[model samples]
Target: MSRFGPVKIVYSDRFLLHDTGGGDHPETAARLEVIWRSLKKGPLAGNIEILEPRQVDRGLLLSVHTEDYIFRFEEACLSGMEMLGHPDNRICYESYNVALLSAGASQTGIDFLEKGQAPSRVFCCIRPPGHHSEAALALGFCFLNNVAIAAKYWQQQYGRQRVFILDFDAHHGNGIQEIFDEDPDVFYVSIHEHPTFSFPGTGYEEDRGSGAGDGYTMNIALPPGSSDAEVLKAMEDKVAGAIEEFQPDCIIAAAGFDAHEYDDMSGLAYSTRLYGHIGRHLSAWADIYCDGRLVSILEGGYSLDALGPSVEIYLGGLCLEA
Candidate 1:
């Protein structure tokens, strides 16, 4: 096994303050709690370092979201508005600042990797989960496109122009794909449930990138009830080939666990162990092409019982060599 730097988890308790309004919301703060508790006591217990996020300037959000949208979302939260565009997007008074903190986790991670800090793997446990957030619209409980902003920040701030984003969320990242649909500098790749049978319904294999980014975007849609085998094949062959061809300078992962067999959010039936495999693949990829630089942002994963163990195993795979 190849050795690497320690793993750092950029997080803040304030992230839990972004309440999903009320009543059995799947995107609850408890998601972070369980994962936090598990990391403290599970197999990899005390093996990782958890750091609070930095004070990220709100203007950095403009790298991905429109200025009008940035102001509108903040106004809605502070003005006591219940939901933004959809009922699925329930918010509380603290959501605006909390979302900034969520996005800040990634910014903190970028600072470490870009500055050649000690940590090689940084995972941001954030909420108001992005990937569905658009330039000026909010969808699927997302407020800001966190991963997209990180990609832009890596490009504009640190000059890591070729950013390879691997999203293994149960649902396709419509907002992420749309944000970089025509930009070749950032490559967005996603593997999720077939749009015909999933929420938001956008990722189609035929929907290749347009214009300069003609072939950068790749959508690997799995049929309902598809299991780990299908996903592994796609990753080993298709995803590996794509990353090889692109040769990215950095790698970002939208790591969502809702695709697990125990989670009811999607029709896909992935086992908890599948996540470990994914982490190993991504870790190896980062080592090979990015000098062990990998930043993963959490997106979705509701089954509280399964989330802890799944995340732990994935983390184990991540720092396996370290």
Candidate 2:
């Protein structure tokens, strides 16, 4: 009864090679481990497919990131620097390579969705999360703007212009907004905790993009302690109408789980079940606007115990419409 084809998860164990200095690092490799383990035994055990991701092509990486920045990042990792730009952006000698693989995961999904086969959702459960990364700067533990790169690939490779991105992470996707702020082709909408109380502090309602892309960027910030009700209301009232008018050819979700009450990474108090609602919203929207051609790239979700269950529930809801 799947509305689309089977759900595919683009992942690679080699992603674990990008060491984050280990210990209590929030962006640990264990994040992916738990999700992988949970999915194997979780309700959707037999219902999903797991596939390895190819390293992103250099051209694809250059589309969103600057040449100088990419080279600087590569040098930092190769030179044995413990971190890149900041303490949060930890790295290992192999991190540069691992990050490329992480960024490439979504493109592999896009390739599947673009094929003439029936449409299905792809979840890129990659690590060293990418939404926080800017073109030339690394912030909040992200090195490459994975979602933005995939959005670019969707347009360039498949000619699917007008890519719509929905980011529901607890923290706003500053990198994603900034990268495509002036590009009318990509519409970036984010629902995150207010900037006043969040890290990186960029997504604000007043900053509605610039130039020809003005009004394309929408930032909806829920106050602290926000729960499912506030989020769903905003989606129905604001997000949905804008997306309908945009009529995107493809959809990319910056799916983050730190907003869950248990995660404590954000003040927003979304429950684990809230993710399913989020997933259902994306699933319905994908079916309606993009023929179920939706891809979700992992963003932030650090709660060791909660991240796994939250992701499983989200994936289940993503496919529930079938």
Candidate 3:
């Protein structure tokens, strides 16, 4: 049904076990449930292949997070603590294991790509989203830094050294930026609502990478009312050039739909249709720069109504003929 081969969706039912107390928390198991139901019934249904995620190795987690912090997180969850370092990062007893599996989704995806698997485009529909998580702290409802760990695994395991991570979440991924800010090998790029108006508040146009990695970090901070035109303009005008210059060995997309106009998580006014364009642009970049080697990990997107459709549209664009 799709021009491209079936897109691999790396996921597992265990991700639902990471409970968030279920009251008014936007990031809940239902988030993944909505996405799964939508994908199964959407136009891309026939083009999707579901795969279970494997548990991530502790050494792989240590690649980005500190050993003490890792121990703290596990102890907190296992000891029946309601939350981690912050109240926003609500966790249940099973959250620690589920977070590991969430991080593992990306590694599983990378493995599929390196093995010359059927689908070149892989999307890890995981939750307990990881972009906002820092090495020593768990902020913004995230546990393990999923995308960051995946980038490290790709480099260490497969020797794909020059990795480019493009995060399009409503809130800046401070954790991701911090992890690779001083590393020249991994380039971290983010396009998010300006930190001045959003949470975790780190990304700024001038916050380029430090020493040895200067200019590797590119941040495009959009105003509160920014729309699809502005996002596309930024992509075409800035992101395109950066990707061309980097010529990365692989691209990891921190895909987030919270910027959608209907989603209350952010002030950005992006529409459901905008996600398709985002996917298309990323797909084209993958084709040109990395031999279609792209792994997209789910990030933010809280609107129950809009999130599902936005994800479906994004996958539709990724599967489109380049």
Candidate 4:
């Protein structure tokens, strides 16, 4: 059952059909389009605002990534070369701007929260998801750390002492964890499959925060066959419990649909209903602790059919009490 009501959803047509080097690309605009088109059939569709996508300036990216990294990423886009490890995830020349815009939508969502907008909740449906891209490398079809930069922006701009990042991606958000692993003020929590069999593999329970950031970073590695019930329990009992203790001013969700049973990427079996339940839980947490400031950034989910219904369930759950 859901508890929150009428969350203001924001999206862009640019996100719905942006081209990222086409042809079997995992992170294609069709992914966003399917979700958008499907959601329009539901009652929650009326509340969504499909706005034009905007560009993210280098200054905002500089906050989280080094200038060298950004330049290299742009060069890769221009050169039409796959990044070192991900030969298949490279973008075309035009894709550089698209990636930045997608990231900008995330930053804009944060901006809306800072401005005290209605719903005080935003979900960036654009991608080239940024959880796996490291400080310099653009792996996993990701270029910049969108959610990380937004979280850091909140901390720097609002003087938020504590920021909680709840990443539920099937794969660990290695880039985000790496960027804030040593920062006490930022708490990175992920409930992902153990990295051993996963790509970019690093989020272990023992990978807790370092030095001043100790005990703040927590990872709950689910086995490949973990079910939806386990996921809910981990969130309600473990993840939520930790957040309540930390009392963060804001919550950033690395909301990935890849765990969907129908998704091609991972073996985690979760129904769309479970994603709704998760979204509702996160919304409740935001209402109680963070003054309802929660921003969800899309990560990975390749199945078009599952992706649309999954997002619809999540947004509907956030907006309609059940």
Best by lDDT: 3
Per-prediction TM-score: 0.97, 0.98, 0.98, 0.92
Off by over 4 Å in 1: 117-119
The clash count of every prediction, one per candidate, is 0, 0, 0, 1
Q: What is the C-alpha lDDT of each candidate?
A: 0.88, 0.90, 0.91, 0.78
Model 2 lDDT tens row, 29-66: 89999898888898888888877799999999998999
CA deviation > 4 Å runs, candidate 2? 1-5
Candidate 4 accuracy as lDDT: 0.78
In candidate 4, the residue pairs with backbone N, CA or C atoms under 3 Å apart (3 or more residues apart, or in different chains) clash, namely 6-319
| lDDT tens per residue, model 1, 227-257 | 9899999999899999999999999999999
> Candidate 3 on 1-322: residue-level lDDT in tens?
6645788999999999999998999999999999988998988777788878998888999989999998999999999999997789999999999999999998888998889645467999998999988889899999899999999999999999999999998999999998888899989999999999998788999999999999999999999999999999999999999989999999999999999999999999999999999999999999899888899999999999999999999988887878
By TM-score, the candidates rank as 3, 2, 1, 4
Q: Higher TM-score: candidate 2 or 4?
A: 2
How many clashing residue pairs are found in candidate 3? 0
Predicted structure with the largest TM-score when compared to the true one: 3
